[model samples]
Target: MSIWGRVFAAGYDRIMEGAEKSVLRAHRQALVGRASGRVLEIGGGTGANLPFYGDDVAELVITEPEEPMARRLEDKLAASARTAEVVRAPAEDLPFVDASFDVVVSTLVLCTVGDPAKSLTEIRRLLKPDGRLLFLEHVRSDDPGLARWQDRLHGIQVRIGHGCHCNRDTLASIESAGFTVSELRHDQLLKAPPIVRPLVIGIAQAKA
Candidate 1:
């Protein structure tokens, strides 16, 4: 990680403390609680989702590209009940065999990946034939006014928020990557900024 990257990651937990307490903690638990079998989690930021995986999960592997963030995640995982191997790698290029993981997880990460499409493709490649993807992401809103604002502020958000884009049509990106969305729910974060509050939570399966 660069100096700026380290700087952003150093304060990441403190910055998100409020959101975690108010809304994200519960949401992450609910989403990660359902994972089963051999699992892979993309962008395990500060290991916030680490405490939520249930015993049904046989093995857990977490990937984080940024060194500073990965280091923090390792620290959190050290104290977690559920053990997980931390891999320093980008989502766009996973170092695993094809059809290896039963479940792939991405929470609040797609928006920040350098290439969401490539990342999803790699995720699909790593999944078993019957594997499913579990995700909780903030996406472009249906409301035109809010979406416009998201678009206008997206560049600035990326610059400051570690490459997060507030206006991506994530559902469309998922579909384009050939994942058949099986279950989807929409909601807003309890106390998040409007640009990033529109949330999409769901399960998606690799297209047969």
Candidate 2:
């Protein structure tokens, strides 16, 4: 990461902390019954999901690349009742064996991966044949005008947000990786200021 990249990530995380926590808190209850067994969460920044997870999960492993963010997650984990493990790594190239996890989760992470397709492929590989991949992501708008604006601002956004893109069609990417969708829901996260895009969330099962 560049010097400016680090600065941008720091500022971005700090600014979005409250909104993210709020959003996660609301959506997390839905995640409780799904995440189970050996779960691997990609881009689990600051261990925000710790509070939401239930006792059903046997183990929780987080892969977070940002060093500063990982430290913050350590602090969060210190207070968490769940026994969690943190890996300072990126989603694109995960360091784990094939079919290693029973559940894989990614929240607002696909938009920033170096290669979203490749990362999803890796996630698929890491998951057991019958494992599930659950995700919450912001995606490209269907509106022509809004999409154009997203395309235009995406360049600048990626620079300041450590490659985070607001226009990725993450659902399509997951489907392209050969996963079978089990359930899905979409909602608008920002209804006032940036009211154009919607949050795309889904739970998919790896084909057996």
Candidate 3:
């Protein structure tokens, strides 16, 4: 991993502190708390969702592609005394068998996947027929002018965020990935810049 990866991992929770206190913590508590059965969380950065997971979850597995982030995630899990497992794995090429999970959680993750379509496909593959996907992602702006701004500033955002695209149509991507969106809500990512503020929190399941 590059030096920036370590730096990013080191400062991950600190940088997100403001947003976490003001907005993200509540969102996570609501969404992640609902996860149950065998669960998988993709790109589990710094293990932020660790505290939110409930005892209802039969098993919890987290995957982080970046080495530095993976190490930090493990450390956090250790500190929290959570018995979850952490693996060094990317979203697109997860090293798991088919239908291995009853729920898959993605929080601020889809946009950073090297291939959103492939990653979502992998998530679909890992989930059982009745499984659900829980997602909380910042997506392309619904407003036109702000979207243009996002397009213009996207490259810089990628460099700063280390591969996260600020203008992805993640909601549409979920639908196209063969998941039926069962519940959804649009909200703003408060305490963050407007370019990446549009958020979508929802639950989806595989199409029958």
* The candidate that achieves the highest lDDT relative to the unseen native structure: 3
Lowest-sum lDDT 10-residue window in model 2: 189-198
How do the residues 7-60 of candidate 3 rate in per-residue lDDT, one tens digit apiece?
988898898998899888999999999999999999998889999999899999
Which candidate, 2 or 3, would have the higher TM-score against the true structure?
Answer: 3
Error of 3 at 119 (Å): 0.2
Local accuracy of candidate 2 as per-residue lDDT tens digits, 25-54: 577668645788999999987666778777
Q: In order, what lDDT does every prediction score?
A: 0.92, 0.81, 0.94
| Ranked candidates, highest TM-score first | 3, 1, 2
Model 3: how far is 26 from its true place, Å?
A: 0.4
Clashing residue pairs in candidate 1 are: none
Query: TM-score winner among the candidates?
Result: 3
TM-score of 3: 0.98
Candidate closer to the true structure by lDDT (higher is better), 1 or 2: 1
TM-score for each predicted model, relative to the true structure: 0.97, 0.91, 0.98
- Which residue pairs clash in candidate 3? none
**Candidate 2 colliding pairs, count:** 0
lDDT of 1 by residue, 151-182 (tens): 99998998888799999999999999999999
